[model samples]
Target: MPVRHTDPPPAPSRAPSSVPETPARTRSQKVADSPSLMAIVAIAAVGVLLYTVFLFDFGHRGDWPAYLLVVVAESFIVVQALISLWTILSSGHDPRDYTFNEAQRALYGNQVEQTMAIGIGMRHAEMQLNDFPITVDVFITTYGEALADIRKTVEAAVAMDGAHTTYVLDDGKSAAVRDLARELGAEYVAREGNAHAKAGNVNHALSITTGDLFVILDADFVARPDFLHETVPFFADPTVAFVQTPQTYGNLRGLISRGAGYMQTVFYKFTQPGKNRFNAAFCVGTNVVFRRTAVMEIGGIWQESKSEDVWTSMKLHERGWRSIFIGTELAVGHTPETIETYTKQQLRWATGGFEILFRANPMGRGRALTLDQRLQYFGTATFYLVGIAPGLLLLVPPLQIYFGIAPISQDVPGLTWFFYYAGFYFMQIVVALFTIGSFRWETLLLATASFPIYVKAFANALLRRDQAWSVTGQKGVRNSPFTFIVPQVLAFVFLLATSVVGVWQAQLDRAFSLAVFWNILNTLVLGAFVVTALKESREIARASRELRALRRAGREPVGEHDEKVVTPVLPEPREERRAVAIKPVTPVPPPRPAIAATQAVAAVPRRHRAVAVRGPAPRPATRPTPLPPLRPAAPRPPAPVLPSQSGPPSISGPLPGLPIGGGPGRARRSAGGPRAAEEPEPRTAPVPVVPSPRRRSASGADLAAEVLSFSGDSFSGDAPARRRDRRSR
Candidate 1:
């Protein structure tokens, strides 16, 4: 069972009013006292003493070599044990590691209030000074990973609800991967060359993208939608640079995978929380959110170190930037299954750690690394080098007995030496078990088994070989050849045979017999590690055959019971989404009393009028030119006078010298003056009617004179004159 961390003392800085301040609880009150724990510690101490005193022996005074061998082996154990004991005791005093389980959280009275306070901070950060939404970029780095595996992670990221964008930083530059990103509705960025592996890939991505806060996820790690919700609130503090969550590998299966996962659990649960107390908690490379400014300040994620995450964290801390490690498992991933993959993974970590120690020593003349931080970093950096002790200890006894060479010339007292050696070892285990909150024998065995690999890693790191990144064994497993274990196997066999022959010889003294037995135990331990490797390879081969058979039968491998393991297919790309602008609703003002049309017009400006007219201009005019004067008529022969029946008076000779329809009674005015009508002209021309022949035609002047006379007599506007003329005609 995982133990909850006791709440640390409240900070002097005021927590948000929303997060009610609470007094800290003592560790004893927080953790219920357990009798079983006390019992285990007592039993372990007794067992160590009894085993050392009775089962093992110090040789006679003549056997000086036996003493030397025991001292050499014990020296490494004592130093490491002392370091572990001190760390555990100090860490347990004020634990920062915790579980989020309900019962555990109840120990902190203000958890809910703290949660609300964080939520409020998130709201503030989300709304910038100008109130525009903050941009968050989620970058999933990939290099030729299976699309199906990465697609799940991408889909999860896209499903997150926030002002965030998800990009797949593909270093492989595969067209198929680009299509996959498009299909999943994620932006895909590919670099031409992998300059510095993952760190370089991320730096290149950082250059092109613009986001206020960025999240990093490995291609296989699927994030919870609420990852930002839980994490971003912590960044409300200006000092916080990044937030790291546990890399929970929930998909691990089989013994090897489970064992590897357990080791991770110990680190995330115990080791990381302890580091957080010193403000030395480093990024674990994935499922971490970093402030853009913080990353930029660190010179773009430290390209020099293979373990960029640690180096980045060290630099950031040195620069006074703070980091946070949340114990929640918000994202999950896979662990290496096969022995070869597992060893490679461990070696890579070991190599990177040593590289940091030598190339850029955190403990050396660094800027602002605190004393506690230096020790913490030193312990981590030198962990792989310590594996050398186990290898040397395993070889010590076999060589001592095989050749008559001894490093010591005299033996020491048995009970005193046993008390010193066994007591240190047992006390270390007790403190570790108590401090870590839980212990698993399998985890210890796994660490013990990896000693040979660590020995090789230490050598490699010293030689500065294998500095580049290699893919972890989470990929498909292969049948591991036993060639990798030949040295280990030889050591195991030599030790076992040496112990048996020494026992059979009967010339060996009690001290020599005890040495043989110790060698026997070392052989078994080494053999167990070899067996683990062999079994892992065999299991992978078996799983491969089973998978192939299932594939041939046109069925996917079942996950649980008869249920199928279905991989999510990428959704089709959606049409571009246009942002819908929303207009604000405002209250309508009440209308004033209606105004008259004239008043309304008066109130309006001329420019604002519906239609406005400019001033009218007068047009110029001129008198019509006088029509050409009517020409005088030409002389013509008079028409034959028609004999007239006498009614009023006889008219003849085409009514000469008068208008065509002018009344005979009307007076006419010559150009000189008005004249009275001339009534009785000579009427001797009243002869019989006869047709007159055609005579000389009238000139144009005569027609013109006739038209003018008609116009003057008929078209003239004198109504009475015209009526009288009609009556007479």
Candidate 2:
């Protein structure tokens, strides 16, 4: 049965919608998807050998204490490097294998001949998996995020191409969020208390809705329409628990957001995909889809830890459920736009890692994890110890300068030390370059300055303290970067004073001490951090001042907006402003025998929309909201959607917010609302301009005579204008 936008009703026997099948990948194509893995491995192999040679070189041992510190610090780095190398080696494995392809084909089998119906009023893309209808519920977990931010996310979530219900799980308890959800045709969900923060909010939603798979998006995330289509097929396998996609960021222009985003980019690009081969791919909270049964099997999202996402993944793994991480970016959202948000985010994540390390060891007995998984999870648990290394290393130069304690003995020549240092550390930098394409100075700076946060997180975890974030954060009241970097400032002051003292000592001895040089380097790194923080603080202050001025002037900044109460329904793929689908290069001739001639010819291909409004629509809402303002013009009655004899076939649907002026037919409408017709108007007939009689020609008939003859009255020589017959094929 063919779906038609025409007035006729659809057949009850036909399935509502379908997904197109993806062709099977050949062996060569599969290999090509991961072409760079082998080069990375080859380089990493050489790097490991060089690292081992330098690490075990005992001939250059200094004072035993200093040597011990150096050994411990360097060892932490090398271990992480090699573990990351292992993960990157496994990154070549593609999750979309033959099994996923077969499932997609079955899901794609629904519509024999179809037209995808989508627009503002009704968004539905119903499909089948394993011949069973499945409902997917999208949960957009939001706290006190801006209303504008929430609207953009909900709009995209509802617009995503799949059969799903979009719910704004507003733990913020804002009435504005509710109104925004209503305005956008999404259901609003609110709860009394956010006990477990994000996890608790989602768990409550899961209880109310019985969807087979639930997609969790942060309040800021705007999902691409195919977000579900890309991840849902993996659920075709009974054992797979969840599918994780990369948390890509669109707000990386800011200093903090850029650094944070790049840091995550590396992991998403390399670490997560590799974890898939071990079946240890963990969820990062957002941009992930989970099977309801799998989440419920683990007693809902784990509430015992702030890092509920990781703990939930662990519990599922212990229950022998597999996880998959697709490296593709399915959604783009905001990263930490300010240092305050960044600090809190890192602290939360680091705390979770420490909690896992101390509380739930993946390698512990009575576990179901594989050896590959145990090592990977164990590595994750111990990963933040690397952060501890930076704190310890920062103190080494001060110790050497003030107390004559050195990690490297005077026996090691400066030239020899340089070779050994470059072998391990430089090789690591090279690996970073190969993996992420380039080294990010912002990432490095942030990482170096971030040890203080990690150490605090460790202490918080060790002491069994809960990290709390202020929910009462006032807009434009963000704290300065100084609030988060007190420790870094102290370290900078201490390192600077030590460097001065070391320089004085070196002058007296008439020697250029390497310890002094190293101390100066550390001081500069800390100084750079302090300088950047101060600069950011100034920028924040300026922005706050401007905001205050705006408030004083009684004008608040506008955020995301929507169309009026009634518009022809259309959900377009992600673009700048909403737009009509691009027209076909050649016009579609007309509906053939396959399509009923009564149906209007569609201008675009089938696309994802949630509930496509077809057949008889209910009476549209009577609220007569005015359309967007336009320049004054003579009133012309809106064209009927039906085929017209005078023009080409009328456009099938309202031209969605097209670049050209949207006609009266494209009234902005909410989902489920039919466009209300305009009040009857008497259209004034257009008068054809008569070209004034040209200057009298010198020939037989003057121009005025010719014009008079061309009118309805026949001329002396005239026959009716001949119609050129179109040739029949």
Maximum-lDDT candidate: 2
Displacement of residue 204 (Cα, Å) in model 2 is 0.6
Q: Give residue 311's lDDT in candidate 1 (0 to 100).
A: 82
Tens digit of lDDT per residue, candidate 1, span 522-612? 7677677677777866776798888898899988653211221121111121232222113333222111122234543444332212111
Predicted model with the maximum TM-score: 2
Q: After superposition, how far is residue 105 of candidate 2 from its true place, in Å?
A: 2.8
Worst 10 residues of 2 by lDDT: 608-617
Against the hidden true structure, what lDDT does model 2 obtain? 0.64
Runs in model 2 with CA error above 4 Å?
1-46, 49-59, 115-123, 469-476, 544-729
Candidate 1 achieves a global lDDT of 0.55
